[model samples]
Target: MSGKFLPTARFLLIVSLLSSALAVTPSAGAQAEPALQTHDVPVAGGPSGEAAQRLADRLGRSHTAGIYLDRTEHRFVITATDERTAEAVENAGAIPRRVTYDTAYLDSIKKRLDTNFKTPGTMWGIDVLANRVVVRADSTVGKKDFAALKKFLAPYGSAARVIRVGGKTERTSSAINGGDYIENGVVSCSYGFTVRKKTDPTYKAILTAGHCTITSGTDWRKSDGTYIGYTTGHNFSNGNDFGLIRAYNSSVTYYGNVEAEGGTAQDISYSRDSRLYETVCASGYKSKYACNSVGLKNQTINYTDGSQVTGMDVAFICRDHGDSGGPLFAGDAALGLLSGSNNSACYSYYQPVNEALAWYGMEVF
Candidate 1:
């Protein structure tokens, strides 16, 4: 959800959430923790990190129970339901733990909840650590809906848990077209990542929040009202929040670096997935450079407006107005695009950059 449409009521909800005991903490141990082995494995959010995630995905598809990143160990921890799968995980260089429910069982539970108990302010997704589906409900979910959700999960018993989070999720659109912001005549947003179409390297484009392009036309401009490009594609409130802007002007520049908080530029070398408990930094017009540790992965956030966004990366990064569609990265590795935040700007969510690039057939250059 975008930050633009948040109302006063939701702002209060954010305050409450922030005060809740469930708020995420920083990862001091994440950096100081000793490595399990002397040999270097891929750091989380690196190429090896991607490989680890893909390996975990394959294991999950093969009905593995759960998978999580052991950041300190620099390896994935997989839960295998059987001896054969445990042996396979050991051979694949992952630490294996025994568990009962496999990915297939967890996925079936999620499907049942989606098909029968779907509610406006409710969402559910796999939580690898718990080996169960985590169901989240926002402030907008009424008692009746929450009750229904509980009843639906009753069959699964301990396989699911419902939790309350602060603030109603909303699309972070509504930046007025003006100087210093990427604009589309009626609205403006922060540029996410500069890219070229995978099929045509010559075609330059910029990625941003898809809701930023919900206006009438695709024409785009810079903050100074300088014409830059047009929206070639966009997706919102339907699984992902990303948009592609194809530049028409040769004079326009696409930088290989992200603007740091103090006006410094940090070069991006590659893109990787966000890891749990890892520190991440975000840059946007309103908040500039803000850093925070990662919280949850594969989170499903329900907005008050009856829209539910799944597979969001939750972080403690602060965000405010006009920060939508900005870059969320960890050092040189690109991670995600700023999607929305709680009212207090204490916490935020991002659409994973890898998924966006794959969906749009584009790559960050």
Candidate 2:
């Protein structure tokens, strides 16, 4: 972690759960779906997002139960609950599909709906081409709490479904001072990458958004106040959000680049895994650089403060409220952090910079 002047350094874009600004009125002679607006017939080679996450981590998690891409036959469907893992996912190029539910049975029905659903405007993930466990719910979720959440999943029928969707999942903080973002002056978030210490390479750090170092504590400043790092470790909740600041200012200096759009800076170089429809891009201190794709992956997010995270990864891109721990890229790899957003259908949500650099073993700088 060395640098090239951070001066006003900014990063953050967390804001997801559901932010669809209430507009579900289409029943009167509806008719929408002009093929959801075309575009998706571009298949050619397909696997790259680190070679489809190294063929879904070399087909592990009991024979891969998830992997997306398929943008109108672009390729990489994966799923495979058996048939010998769909012949090792079509011999590792990806196209599988088989599915009945694996990936440890949809991660044990998302850990029994994250241990008896906390339900705050609700949320849930794992679609793996619809293998199950969707959930969603919003509009403040109250039809008797969506019918006791469909009678507590009616014992996992069809593995789980539910559905409703339309805004109402919030958690946005702001204070971040340092000319523009990276704040611990109180509660500001976003600044995700510039790490070290795969066994102590003089240990440096920054990766953000485990609810912003558990609600902005663990000292971390920058806008002239200096100080730069501390939250040594963090994980927002059961599904995980991510954190780990540690840098401790060795006279502050850190760079690998990232912060692009106009003021320029991009070069990250490594970190992948997140490839359902590919194309990502994020950077925030209030929705800075934007670009989208990768609609869902692993995902689980269930917050309204009932707090519950889980391998998140969705993207439509929009982010706001100081974009919590920003940076979710594509050009120079490095793939996630922006941990949440919806700002009326902006739909971001992240956390997977190689599983927070392998749960803080760290890397990237």
Candidate 3:
């Protein structure tokens, strides 16, 4: 988004999910709690701090998010709506920490965005709100620099005092402009590390959804920007978008639709998406909260502006694009693949990550 400072549903959803089953409710043995203002706590947006950083990236500044600060640890937190955003924030030199938010707050944010900001810049359904900071072009303002834009936003919100976020401009036509830059936009794939398929020290070839492919001719690699393999096969625009390319020499690994908490792993991978009813969780790159999940799996899903999305896919409390190809596990069984979500750009959907693997002859952990 160009410039806008507004909270969103992404905040509430993440807060609800994290504060719910995840955060260890202040234990009985915990220290006495202090009296607090339920509404005044300065809550940062999203679970991952990427939202803030992305805004900064676009604005050409540094803004960190995910501050779980209080009396205990005074350190700032960064929440990336997805793994890539998380990585980007970290790479950009911000201190990142995973986080979530309250549902009521999220609900209120949605209502607020409608009421506030007469004009929005862009909408990604994440940390940053998409509203225009400059209503008049009296003085030329370039979209490339946010510092000037932040000056415009200071009156509404503390652009300086608050966390900043980064954003990427939409890529223009690469097909027609035949300049000499070597080529095509990259189709990338990133998968949640599977547990079953990996050991402590050995490198494992992880499987991922194929829609994320950069095409068959390109090679695949780790997020660190190293080559690992290539797209041997892929499918997209349907219940497809799966791909398989084994590690050149590493052992293939698997991860059940579950997660590791402290010392325990929960099996979240659903065998049949048709039966999904209860609140399911999803994660994506809002550039704010890293892996933010929302409750309530909405039915009658839509896409690309209310186009009906067919078949059964998983929906979480919240998530977004850039989080695509991420794993969507129910407990520890590897449920689905993070595809697209209907709830604006803030939420996301996933194909069965395991199924994508299976089609390519890759095994799930």
Candidate 4:
């Protein structure tokens, strides 16, 4: 079911129920934070989280601009433009708050900035909670460029906010690695989700980081240097960093499961859009499977080397080298592909799996 069909009240009840069901004990290694307070709402069950996400997407497509799942309250809080939109949200069983800027306007602001300022150290995207477009510049943003960007966006007024993000964002690529390692020469990276072309289900391919494929014609190999496939499609620039490897060995088996930290495999049933405050897990060669809470959505990251990637999601999950191209999942749903991380490895960004699938016309196996 899509988000449009869920009643706001029923959605909250369902969320509350699911949250209770899936509540996990904090792993000893998990850094604990204070629990967020919940809204005073009666709990009940109605739809799944995926259904709530669909409703959110539907609202997002309408006059409503932004939506975030309040995990503590077990409900979605929506931002709308008018009384009519608010009423509509109430009718759909969501909590609606009136906001001045809709998502379209915020997205337009981002587009305009992208067109006017190709500054390498800066990135911008819609921040749903603030109901505004947020532009972040890393330490590498020179004084001249930062000032120029500020001047360019000044006319946008309060519609945008510029902030400084510490450390440089760089592509996560190095040797280490276990989601089944794929090696090219001496370089090693983890395999992402296995996929099949929409037009030919029998045609198998593996998804990975495009930066890993920068050296064209480099045949991908197994850990022992056995031939596996070659990089078929890649896009490390122009806003995305995903690559596809067409596997020649039809006998190569890829299950719809992710190997967790303890060698157990978790089944992947589907793919869904990520929401703020939601719990997610990642599996990489270096870090294995680690679960963490998602903190941001629709973010843009600027690399120190001057490359910029937009439409990314961030989480307070640990990652390291050889983690790029790994999978980021929520329950059984595929969410994103590991892209890059900040200087601390404590936080990482992902390329949404939906975008990559749409771009490649492929589906997870």
TM-score per prediction, in order, is 0.79, 0.35, 0.38, 0.80
Q: How do these models rank on TM-score, best leading?
A: 4, 1, 3, 2
Model 4, TM vs. native: 0.80
Kindly list the per-residue Cα lDDT of model 2 for residues 1-365, writing each as its tens digit: 11111111210011121223224321111221111111222235555444655676777777776676555555656666668777876776666767666677777877787777778757676666556677777677789988887888778787677877666666555664334567765788768788788788777788888887886467887656677877778887667778888878768778877886665898886776667656677777665676656666776676676776677787766676777888887777788887766555456678788877987778785
lDDT of 4 at 187: 59
**Taking the tens digit of each residue's C-alpha lDDT, what string does model 4 give over 16-49?**
5423322332232353343222223321232234
lDDT score for residue 322 of model 2: 73
Clash totals, every prediction: 12, 20, 97, 11
Error of 3 at 228 (Å): 2.3
TM-score, candidate 2, is 0.35
Q: How far out, in Å, is residue 8 in model 2? A: 49
Q: Residue-wise lDDT of candidate 1 within 1-365, one digit each (tens)? A: 21212223533354344345235533211232221221135544232444555666776654576555555455566677788877877776766766666778888887677666547655567766556787777677788888878887888877776777555555565656343578776776788888778899888788888777756768987777678888888888666888888878888777767886468898876777777555678888766676755656766666656565667887776666677898988777788987777643355779999888998787876
**Cα lDDT listed for each candidate:** 0.68, 0.67, 0.35, 0.70
Off by over 4 Å in 1: 1-47, 57-63, 176-180, 343-347
Off by over 4 Å in 3: 1-185, 193-205, 214-217, 249-275, 283-302, 305-309, 342-346, 353-358
